[model samples]
Target chain A: MKLFSVEKPGLYTTYQDLGRVGYLKYGVPASGALDRFALQVGNILVGNERGAAGLEVTMQGPELLAEETFVMAVTGGDLSPMINGRRIPLWKSVLIKKGQVLEFGQPRQGVRAYLTVSGGFHAKKYMGSRSVYEPAGLGRKLEKGDELVGEPRQQKAGTGLFFTEIPDYDRDVDVRVVKGPHHEQISDKVVSDFFAMTHDVSPQSNRMGYRLQSDLATNHEANVISDGVPLGGIQLPGNGQPIILLADRQTTGGYTRIGTVIGPDLPLVAQLPPGGKIRFKEVSVEEAQEAAKQEEQKLRIWERFTR
Target chain B: MKITFYPLGEAAVKCCFHEDISTALTYNIQAFCKKLVHQKHVGISEWVPAYDSVAVYYDPWKLSYEEITNVLVPIANEMDAHEKKTKTVITIPTVYGSDYGPDLENLAAANKLSTKKVINLHTKRHYLINMIGFLPGFPYLSGLDERIAMPRLESPRQSVPAGSVGIAESQTGIYPLDSPGGWNIIGRTPLKLFDAEKEEPFLFEQGDYLQFTAISEDEYKQIQREIEKGTYKLERREESE
Candidate 1:
């Protein structure tokens, strides 16, 4: 059934899920929600499956008019979401009536947010996924006058998350990293300098990867044989700048990567807007794995309790 | 066939041969990938086979990094002993020169060869597929004839049409999708390199061999129509190696 009509297609809004997998070997990127935790929480709040398709709103949120009454939850970077000119709470499921308009104001916290309805958005699936990867034309961003289709439910039992469960996007984040495959190839001085300096998220950052700038400079010939690149792998090009490969990063690259940001800290890094401050701390492989396990445990616990 | 294991991240590990790029190394990597698929290790999600390495992605919740590396070491030891299997070489019908390949004349001049000679050199060899990357179904084929090999454009074109064949350095490939590319285009193919609607979306796979046969523009249009009507039969033959 028709759920919402797009009055305004906010800055680069697109439907996304967990991501497209098993096609990286064929050069297909695993384009998915950058902040996976937010998308998962949004889906769960609206009583939808964890991996259900949802609207991934960017810095500005779209003005969507509700065609039918349904339940929705907005999670991730707070863009000051509102309904019918009245402010709505973030990280909580809310009921919307027919003809009610939902929009967003200034980005008070993170730059991205996920809006998931009870039945999830019914975007056309390409290659076993609904995630919109604009480059290869697999899918596209939402445009004005587009009608969003979904499975509307009558139940309006809304849910709200605890204060401790929410993440603070306004502050500078320290992300944990594990040594990458080519870590040994980098000089000890360069590696130490990387950890010592504070990096700023470059304006050229996008879903493909985030280009970070720091004061440290080295004429390091960091080029290596082209090889498979992992998500969150920190690629150090010849200019000695770091590029954090994200959800839409290519499957393989030629540059040498020093370290990879742990999975648990990926969402935090994803939320950082342009000019946001970040620091990286090295951790053992075991420690990184343990952090991932703890994060997974939180998700499992939430899944058991909610719906 | 010694391989070293390192953590790509918490969930993925890089199994590197630490060897230079060679056909033998490519085969060993392909063979190891095949063995990996057969094992069906728990928590392993997907793997990407590149020049001299295979990156194995797994679920940290299901298995730890250390546990996965232990499973991979045994597979590496047995990979070299596997016999080489017969392969299939897929032939691509291409239309050379004119608007289909805008850079053909320029490349021919740079190499001090006639446009016809360049075409002949490009089609003479059956190139081995090193990897499929950069763009979906974009095969990084090796064995480009040195006579026709050229560097990429200084500034990449904003949009190179899909199936546009190009050469860069010692490598040659066909763009599976319309994307910004710097390679020197010399021909075009009507066959879709990538079709998301199909059961197997990608036309080429890693380890498969590719052969290019020059075709007339009219034949290109005919093949395009057949492909659109779902009547085109992909030409395939047993590897002559």
Candidate 2:
């Protein structure tokens, strides 16, 4: 099976999965989907396994040509779709016919969209991943006039695939964090003020990190060696703006982490676009993990709830 | 080689050494990383290796942070014991001037010497790999001659091409990919520091020793053509000392 060449590529379109994990030792950034939950939803809709590589089109999307037949699904954000210039709603499974043109027009709401194919695209997987790290030019962002060849679907669903209920994804999400190892070094007043303050996501934020600007006070050691930084670690620079680590962040960092946005809440952090405002509440490590499991359970229940 | 355990998150623990980067410390990280990857520990997914530290991501249900840290101390000490046996030396070939090496003359003049002198001093020293980071396969090499210390460019260029030999902050490194960089370019090497197409994408790994040798522009072109033709072979450096 084959996917058509891109007639018009919009914004940033790239291949992504859960990410390139276990390669930080050689300084490879773990490049993956910004919103893993959204990506999973898209994959699940098409009956693809979670963590399978797919198209992560941000806000504006590419105009694609479909060369062969396959069950495709789009999940994430509120972006209107068009098949051969006809309007189609998002978050629902759509059967793409052979030689038809598919495109995502202007984003009416969310900043990201996830599109998943049946068997996943046939891309060269490096280090057990097909996620492209654009900076490294390994698996690059899908560019204009690029022909995409997809792998054949492995599962034969004798009954054509379709999902009845669209997922209920809340745009407004609150993320919780755990106080970091260096949290105490930063004043208690700052910690208290941080929880009290609400921050707006700066335009400066991207896959590498999320930079938030707020009235919250900040502090950092001028001379510090780099250390292994966990995902969602909130580091406050000397300038007072807080930077949260993401999938493509460096293996180690020199900044001071005020808190670590727990694992479960990391998906919430990923969905935030520039100018998004949010606040963080502190929780214990044990509580963080428990919340993660609970959050996972809630996600599983989302499908059942709609059904 | 000995490291203290610190909890990074519920699923991972960081093993950090005391301040300072060196060969011995890098070796310790290598040995520990080797062990962690091979062991069938419950919940331990993978360990990320670095110059003076290792970030071990594990499953909380299988192994606690305390358990991984407790197992790491003895292995860290053991890596130091076998450092001599695992020590490896690698040499890189470089060409001095022309279109390939754009900033060679400037770096040579800044050091109050001819371009030849700069190349001689750079190639003469046997440098140790401190760590690999900043970019894929980009190594932070220590033991540079203090005389050639040069600060990074006042304003970094938007893209420094691959295999660009650069110096900054009394240290030297090669740009593995075309990225926004400020390092002072001394010369360019035709060697592929990074190649995603290969079995081992990175030609050089952490903790390995490196030596540079001077080559001609013709030789550079020859290597480039051969590399494109898939017949280029780089000479290996024998490791004893």
Candidate 3:
């Protein structure tokens, strides 16, 4: 049976798994969920694997019409999802029958949301991932009248699961970052200025990168021979603008990267809306790894709760 | 050669070989990359190799930054000891002049040479793939003939078509996908640089050598037809050292 049909594609809705892994050498970006924690928890609530393919709804969530009896869950942003015009709860799995329309209004919190079914999205896996990396022609964003198929599910337990602590998307966030591979290449004065700078997310920011508004200049010519870019790489182009490379960023670039946003704090950056204010906090790599460990511990706790 | 390890992020470590770009440094990177892949570690996830450095991404939950560096240091030390493998040489079929070659005249004029001379110069050298980047399957090739070198356009094209063979300064490459680029387009290739359906999506790898074979417009059409029919086999040969 058809899982759902897109009534409205919303701002942007695409299928994302953990990301396309092991393909960076070939220039494939690790295009995956922006808010991976939210996606994982959504999958956990729906009794799916952590890396299952799910819909990554942007500022506005897609309006979907279910065509079969299935269990589904919505996580990440509070997009004000409603089933047949009645408001539905976030972070909980719910049952829907045929003809029930799942409509998502304006987001109440965060920028992106995840929608997961008991079984993952039935999509083609390119290079071992279902992520929609448009440049590589792997998959595409959801459009009106587009039909999506899901794997046949037996419907296990774990419905109505709600996390005690939900992320506050509206608050200003401190994006923790580590000294980069090319950090030393930058001037000490510029590094200090970078730390002191208060930046706002550009309206042009997308899956590829978050262009931060900062007129900060580096000491040297911001050109490298071209090197592999890590996710969350804050690359300072010759234009003196900082572009935080994200999920759909090109695998490599010629611009000199000042630093990399810590993996644990990437979600904080991802949750911010356009014009969202963020401050870069330079921390030791050890501290960043410690934060990551704590975050992983939190996820593990959630994993236990969901099961 | 000193190998310095730096924290790329919370979960990955980057090892830099040297600042300069050369065949020797690239070979060292390739050799180190070979070792990392062959002797895979439990926590190691992926290795992203570029012109002068390789970033090793790992599972933070499984391994710490210190552990990752510890794992890489020895392998990096032994990289020079590893015997170099024969390189793979792939031939790219390109149709030069007219629409197939958008900036052929511009490139030739910039170098004060005839269009045919530019094409001949471009096809003469065996260009090395320093890295695959900027776009998927986009090869950053070196060894462009000095006479035909051209600077990037002052204003980049909003969108360059896929399979466009372009030259910028001392470098030449093909656009694997339609993307905004600043390179001077000299010709077009019929081969798909990247195919999502293929088991191995990319047409070339880092350290692989590329040779562009000039073809006619009719040949380009025929090759395109064969490619679409899934019958065209890319011409490749093992480079004997």
**Arranged by DockQ, best first:** 1, 3, 2
Report every candidate's CA lDDT.
Answer: 0.90, 0.75, 0.85
Q: Which should have the higher TM-score, number 2 or number 3?
A: 3
Docking class of 1: high
Q: Which stretches of candidate 2 lie over 4 Å from their true place?
A: A82-92, A99-101, A105-109, A151-172, A215-219, A294-307, B40-42, B60-67, B70-74, B77-82, B97-99
lDDT of 3 at B241: 57
lDDT of 1 by residue, A128-205 (tens): 899999888888998999999989677765598888989988548899999877877778888899998889999999
Report the lDDT tens digits of candidate 2 across residue range A1-307.
4577888887888888988766776778887888777787777666667788888887788899998877777776656778899876566567877888888877766677888888777777988799988787777888888888777464432222244434333445577877865775777888888888778888888788989887565554622456667778788777778888988888777777787887766766666667777789888766766666665665565544322
Q: After superposition, how far is residue A37 of candidate 3 from its true place, in Å?
A: 0.5
> Residue by residue across B1-241, what tens digits does model 3's lDDT show?
5788878888877788865888777778888888888888898989889888898899888888888888888877876643666778899999987987789998888789999998889889899888887778888888988898888999999998899999888889999888898999989999999988887777778888999999999999999999989899999999765
lDDT of 2 at A181: 59
Clashing pairs in 1: none
Listed in order, the DockQ scores are 0.87, 0.41, 0.81
In model 2, the Cα lDDT at residue B41 comes to: 65
Q: Number of the top candidate by DockQ?
A: 1
For residues A1-307, could you state the per-residue lDDT of candidate 3 as single tens digits?
Answer: 5899988999889999999779999888999998888888888888777899999988878889998888898888888889999988888888887899998888788888889988889888888999998766788888899999987476754365444667667647888889787767888888888898888888888999889888886567788767778988899876767988889998888888889998877888888888888899999988988888887787777677665
Error of 1 at B170 (Å): 1.2
Worst 10 residues of 3 chain B by lDDT: B78-87
- The lowest-lDDT stretch of 10 consecutive residues in candidate 2 chain A is A156-165
